[model samples]
Target: MTRDEIFKGLNEVFQDVFDDSTLEVEEETTANDVDGWDSFAHITLIVSVEKKFGVKFSMGQVSSMKNVGTMASILLEKLA
Candidate 1:
């Protein structure tokens, strides 16, 4: 999927995981930018994104991502 498409879906996952319907994610958005984005929430977000995209992220990939943009790039690469 294109980056825009991935971001659209990723936004939904983030909002859902955070229980905030109004949450909007930009390329630079990170856990620190969102309230309630603790470690448990991070795992939930990862699992939700994986299920939504039908993609599995390696531990390294998950740990290495710094922001939404990086996650979108990885998703695009895996989907490709």
Candidate 2:
């Protein structure tokens, strides 16, 4: 899938996870930068993304996704 298409799903995940429509995401966005983002929430977000994209994540890979850019790249690679 194209990055923009993937990003649309990403944006939905962000909106649902953050509960804020105004929050803008960038490649630099990380869990540390967002309030209310914790390990539990991260898993929920991952599950949502996996559902949206129909992909699965290994524990090691899930443990390694550190930021939005990394997540996007990984998702792209997986979908590719």
State the displacement of the C-alpha of residue 32, model 2, in Å, after optimal TM-score superposition: 1.5
- The residue-by-residue lDDT of candidate 1 on 9-37, one tens digit each, is 99899889988999999999988999999
Best by lDDT: 1
lDDT for each of the candidates? Answer: 0.92, 0.87
RMSD of 1: 0.6
Per-candidate TM-scores read 0.96, 0.90
RMSD of each: 0.6, 1.1
For all candidates, what are the clash counts?
0, 0
lDDT of 2: 0.87
